[model samples]
Target: MKYQFPENFWWGSAASGPQTEGAADVDGRKPSIWDYWYEIEPGRFFNGVGPKNTSNFYYQYKEDIALMKETGHNSFRTSIQWSRLIPDGIGEVNPKAVEFYNNVIDEMLKQGVEPFMNLYHFDMPLSMQEKGGFESREVIEAYVTFAETCFKLFGDRVKYWFTFNEPIVPVEAGYLYDMHYPNVVDFKRAAQVAFGTTLAHAKAVKAYHALNLDGKIGIILNLTPSYPRSQNPADLRAAHIADLFFNRSFLDPVTRGEFPSDLVEILRERDFLPNYEPEDLEIIKENTVDILGVNYYQPRRVKAKENMPHPDAPFMPEHLFDNYEMPFRKMNPYRGWEIYEQAIYDIAINLRDNYGNIPFFISENGMGVEGEERYRNSDGFIEDTYRIEFIESHLKWLHKAIAEGANCHGYHLWTFMDCWSWANAYKNRYGFVEVNLDENYKRTVKASGKWFKTLTSQNGF
Candidate 1:
C-alpha cells in the first residue's frame, strides 16, 4: 500500500538556538540561565559537557541549510535565542544577533526551504532569571516585549511563528522535578510558573495580532496522551486528572481560550492556585493561538493510586496517580520511552473532535538512540534502519488520521542533526544526519537521512 502526504507538506525537522547554535559567549551574546548554571555548577550537566559544546549552528548554518535542502526539506524550524538577541532581555537589541538571524533566514529561503521560527525554547536570559523567571509578572512583560521585537524584525520572512517550544517543560523541570535550572520542588511555584508562561504566550499572541503581521503565531506543546491502566472508574478518573495536569494545562488555554475548570477547582481546593490578576484571565480569553504544533514522543500510562501522599511531603502530580509500565509494551531501549505510534492518530482525532480542527503540524517526533556510532557502516554513513522504521510507523498512523479528516498539515522530526540537550548533552542522537563532534563537527548523512530525502520527494514511503 502507498501513503501520500498532502501537497506542499512541511517536510523537515526542528532544532533550537541553545541546543544547536553554540557561540555561548561570542557576538555580544549574554548568558542564558543554562550558561550561568553551567558556570556555577559544571558537574550538573552530563559528563560536565555544557551548552558551549553544541553543533556550532551559529557558524555552520549555511552548510546546515544546504544539508536541509539535500534532505528534501521544504521547510525547517529553529529558534532565536532571546539572550542572544536582546542581551539584557529588554531595551537594546544586539545588531550581530539580528544580522546572523537574517542571514540564516535568507539562506534557508534561498535554498527553497521555508523557515519556521520559534521565539523561545527553554533558554531564559540570565537577566530574566534574576527577575524570578516565569514566576514573576515582570518577566512576563519582558517576554512580551521580546516577542514584539521578533515580530517587528523578522516576521516579514518567517510565516510560521511559535511562541514557545514545550512550554510545560520549565514548569515540570524547574519547579516540580528539579531537573532544570533554579531547580526547586514546590507545587505552588510550579503552578505560578505555568500560569505566567501561558499568560506570556497569550500576551505575545495579542502583540502579534496587534501588528497584523502576515504570519500566523502559535505554540509548540508536547502532548503526551494519558492512558488508564484499566477499565475501572477510578483508573479512568486518574487518567483524566493526569491529562488535565499534563496536556490540557496548556492545550485548553491555547486552543479553547480557557483553562480547564476542573483543573482550576482542584488547584483551588488544594490551595495551590497561582497568583493571577483579573486582567490576565481576559488576556488569555482574548488571544488564543491561531495554530498549534504538537510534539509526540511517548504516552503517559497511569493507574489510580492506592495510597495517599504523606501530608508532610511536598505536593507533586505523581501523588494522585502511579505510572504504569505495561508488561508487554514496546519501548525505546536507548531512551527508556514507550514507543506508541497510535498516539499520533489519537492526538489528531482529539484535535478534530475538540479543537475546531485548527491547522497544525507535528513539530517534533523522532527516535533517540545512544551510541549511534556503532551503527556506522563501512561506507562512512550511519545505517540508521531503526530510525527509518520508527518514523514510518508513526507516519502511517498520522496518514490514517489525516485521511479521517484531521487537519494536520505536516510532520517535522525532533531535530535535523545530533545536537546538545540541556543536561543530557549529546548522549542520545536524534538526527537524520549524524554530527561527528570528534571529527571537526563533520556532518554525515545517515541511512535515515537518505530515506527521509526519498520520503519527502515522493511525499511518502
Candidate 2:
C-alpha cells in the first residue's frame, strides 16, 4: 500500500524544448532542424501541425509551473533549445532567448521545483545541419561552445545537467533510417555520426566540468533491454548482439569509457567501423558522466535472423537479429509495446552490476494512446487508470531495486503536459495533463495526474 523513496527524491516529468516552446521565429530565435525539416517536407508531420503549434510552453510556462506545483513536482527535466540560444549554432547568444530561459529557471526555483536541464535533444540548428550536421568536426566545435555557454548561463541555480538526450535516436533516424531530417542511408555515414556524437558528448562534459560549476552533469540514454526468443545458444547469442548494438553502443563508452571488444570486432569484421583517432578513445575514457539517465520504454524481443541478407543490402542492426514476440508476452491493446514490468528491475540491476552503480534516474517512460479523451466523463477529466497502473507497475520494481542497493535515485515520466510529437503530432498524448490545441492551449489534468499528486505526496501509489 505504501513505499517511500529516499527523502527529497526528485519528482517530476521530462520535456524537450522543441516539443514545448512555440516562439519558433520571434525574439532572435532561429529555426531548428525540426523547423527546417517540417518546412521542406510539410507532409512529414502529423495533422500538418509543425513545431510552431507545440504546447506553447514559451507563453504558458508560468501557468504550467503553477500546475506542476499543484501536482506535487519537486524537480523537473527540460532541455534548452540549441537553436534558440545560438541561432547560427555557435555564434551570438540571443538575449531574448536568455531572458526566456532565465524566466523559466526563476519560475521553477520559486515554485520549489529544481530544474534539471539538458543541453541538447534531437533539435539541431538548421544552419548547422546545412554545413554538415553531426558529420563535420566543425559542428562538434560549435557544440562545445554552445554547451559551455549553457553552463555559464544556467549552471548557478540548476544542479542537475544533461549533455544529450537519446543521442542514438538522431543518429539512427537521421543517418541510417529515413525518419528524421538530413536523411541519409549510408552505413559509413551512420558510423561517422555515431562516433561524432560520442565525441560531442565528451566535449560538452569536458567543457561543463572546466567551468567548475556547482552541479552534476550527465547524459540521457534509452537502454532497451534485450530478450532472446528461446533458450537456444544461437538465440542467446543473437540477443547478446542486439544488446551490444542497441544498449551498449552508447552505454559502454559513456559509462565504462570503452567500446565493448565484441562490438568492435563485429564492426571490424563487417568493415563498417568509423575512422577513430587514438585520442577519440582518450576523450571518452576521461569524460565519463557524473550521473546517468536511463530511459526504458520496452524490452527488445530478438532472435537470430531467419536468413542472411544479400551482400550489399546494407548493415542494418536488425539484419543480425529479428524481433520475435513471445506468445504469452503481455501487450497493451491501446498501444503496440509489450508491457513487461520486470524489465525495469532488470535495467536497474544491470546498471548496478555492470555500470559501476553510477547514480541515475529514469528520464522518460509512458504509454501512448491514440484516443485518450474517449474515456473522459461529464467532468471533462480522462479516467486514465491505465496510466496509473503503468506507473505503479514500474515503481514496484524500482522500489525493490532501491531496497536491494541499486544506485537509482529518482524517476520522471515521459512528459508533464501533452506536447506535439515529431510525426505523431498530438495524436499520441502521453501526459498527466492534457492540452487542448483548439482552446488555445487550455490544460486539463487527467485522472492520472490526480493519482500522481497523491503518489508523490506519499512517495508511492
Candidate 3:
C-alpha cells in the first residue's frame, strides 16, 4: 500500500438524523424546522419532497449497520434529532426515541462499528425555533439541557460526541442567506445568532466535562481555506477579512478560546457585535473543545471588492470582498463547486502549524452527483468512477499531510448512503451505497462503494 494510515484510524462516513431517519412525526418524534418549512412552502423543496421522505433509517438501522460492516466501516457518525429525543426540545424524554437510539447505538457496537454521535445537525426543533432558535438566550439554555440529556442517555457507549455540526450554517443560511427556515436577512441578527450558538456550544462543552465522561467532545466545522486572488495589498486584505468572517469566527473561539481581535474590531466599528453577558466570555474561554472535526469541501477564492453595495444596502460579509473565479479552475459541474483537492492539505497544514497540531479528522468530504443513475452498469451497480477518483485524490493529499505530521486521524466521507438533503432533497446522490428511492429506498453498493471497501481493507490505495 502506498498510503497506509496510522493504526486505529477511523474509517467510516457520516449522515444526519434529519437526512436519513424518515419518521418525521412517528414514534413521538415532533416536527423540526425542516418539517415546518416543508409544510408551509412545499414548493421550496426539490420535486416537492420533504423531510418525511428520507431513507427510512429509523426502521432500517440494523440493516444499514450491516451494510456499514460490508463497506469496511470501523466507525460511523450520525446525529440524534433533538425533536425526536425530546419531542418539544425540552422537558420529558420520549421513550420511543430513547429505545430507537439505544437500539441504534447497540447495533453499531454489536456490528463492530463505533458510533460517533453529534447532538445537533442543523435541525432546530420547531418548538425551540418558535422561541427564537439560537437568537434568544433562553433557547441557548434549552439547547444546553438537550445536550446534557443526550450525554446522560448515550454518552457511555458513543465515545465521540460533537455538540454541533457546521454550526455556522444556521447563522449563514437561516439568518443571512434565507436558504433555510425562519429566513431573515439581517447581519446584526445573524451576528447575534452566531454568538449565541458559540455560547451554547461552550456551555454544552462545560456541561459534558462536568460529567467526567470517558469520551471526547468537539464541534464539526466546515473549513474553507481562503486564498487571495493576487498579492496586491487590497486583495490580501479582502482575503483576510473573508477568512476572519467565515473561518476564524468560530474556529478561534472553539480552539483558541478567543475571537480574533480584528474580527472583534470590525464588528465593534459597525456596532454589529452581538449582545453577550460578561460571564459568557468566561464560559467560552474556559470550555474549548477536546477534538475538532473538519468538513472540507472547497476553498474560498476571494479578491478585493470590485463593486460596493449601495449605502442603503444591508451590511454583509461580501461588502469586504468579492469571490474570485480563477480561469480554468477545476469544477464539480454537478454541484457547482470548485474541486480543489489541495485545500484539504492546506487545512491540515493550518491546523498543524497554527492550532497546536490538535487531533482532528476529515469529518465530511465527498462528491454529489446529479444523475448518478445514468452511470449504472448492466451488473446493477452505479459505475461511479468519478467519486472514487475524487476521494482518492483528496486522500493522497491527506496522506502527504499526515506524513508531514498533521494531527488528522480519520477520513469519513460526507455520507455512507444516499440520503435526503434539505431543500436539495435527493437531487444529488452522495452515498457509497446507491439508494433507489423509486424501489422503496433500496440500497446497493456502488462501484465506489466496492472501491472504498478495498481502500479500507488495505487501509489505503
TM-scores for all predictions:
0.99, 0.98, 0.99
Which scores higher on lDDT, 1 or 2? 1
**Tens-digit lDDT string for candidate 2 (4-80):** 78877777899999999888988888998899888889898887889985899999999999989888888899999
Q: How many residue pairs clash (N, CA or C atoms closer than 3 angstroms) in each of the candidate models, in the order given? A: 0, 0, 0
lDDT of 2: 0.89
Give the best candidate by lDDT.
Answer: 1
If the candidates were sorted by their lDDT against the true structure, best first, what order would they fall in?
Answer: 1, 3, 2
Clashing pairs for model 1 are: none
**Model 2: number of backbone collisions:** 0
Report the C-alpha displacement of residue 29, candidate 3, in angstroms: 0.8
- 10 residues in a row with least lDDT, candidate 2: 1-10
What TM-score, to 2 decimals, does candidate 1 have?
0.99
Off by over 4 Å in 2: none
lDDT of each: 0.94, 0.89, 0.94
**Model 3 lDDT at residue 378:** 98
Select the stronger candidate by lDDT from 2 and 3: 3
